[model samples]
Target: MGWLLLLAAGCSEIVFAVSLKFNDGFTKLWPSVVTGISGIGSFYLLMLAIRTLPLGTAYAVWTGMGAVGVAVIGVVWFKEPADWVRLASIMFIVVGIVGLKLTHAE
Candidate 1:
């Protein structure tokens, strides 16, 4: 359940991040609204996840996965280049997340 909440937080983070591209520095209307709402939801879910999980573990997973997801979104949706180092770093983040989970006391 806590993991699910954490994933939800990460998803919200991705949404807000991608929306930032469309938000046009908060000049746009709809994208800015979406960004605001998703950002709030992301932090709320992050708080909930930390209720059951270690703060450091939950925060690392949330930010790490959010970063990886947004990078993928940038490549696939925005046609950004997927460099080798970027991909490798994403893999490292995945491994780190797994290690945190495995070593988590709860």
Candidate 2:
């Protein structure tokens, strides 16, 4: 269940991050509002995940996952530059997240 909570937190982080692209610098009303709510919710879930997971490991995985997810979204959905170097960096973030999850002490 702790892992599930952590995953949920990571998802929320991704949502908040991707929504930022649509927020128009917080000018677009609906997307900005959604982004604000999601950002708060992400932080809330992250705090909950920390209750059962080691703070260092959980935070590293959460942020890494969020970064990777947002980078992918930026590339695929927003047509942002996703050159080989950027893709490789995102892959490293995924690897780090996986490694932390596997090695994290319960």
Candidate 3:
């Protein structure tokens, strides 16, 4: 349950990040609304997750998920660089997230 909450939080974080780009520095209307909603949703879900999960582990996984997700979105949706180095770095973040999940007890 905690992991599921964290995953939802991460996805919300990804949406929050991507919406920031479209928000035009909060000058836009709909995008800004989306950003605000998703940002709050992410934090709320993460808070719920941390109730049962280790705080350090939950925070690290949350951030790692956001970073990797945004990077992938940048590459695919924005047509940003897909160079080997960038891809490898994203993979490393993923590995770390997975490692934290697997190693976590209770």
Error of 3 at 32 (Å): 0.4
- The local distance difference test score of model 2 is 0.88
Residues 1-106 of candidate 3 have per-residue lDDT tens digits of 9999999999999999999999999999999999999999999999999999999999999999999999999999999999999999999999999999999986
RMSD of 2: 1.2
lDDT leader: 3
Put down candidate 1 lDDT per residue, 69-89, tens digits, no spaces.
Answer: 998989899888889998898
TM-score of each: 0.94, 0.92, 0.98
Q: How much is 106 displaced in model 1, in angstroms? A: 3.0
Q: Model 3 residue 70 lDDT?
A: 96
Question: Could you tell me the lDDT of residue 98 within candidate 3?
Answer: 93
List, in order, the clash count of every candidate structure: 0, 0, 0
Better of 2 and 3 by TM-score: 3
Over 4 Å off, model 1 = none
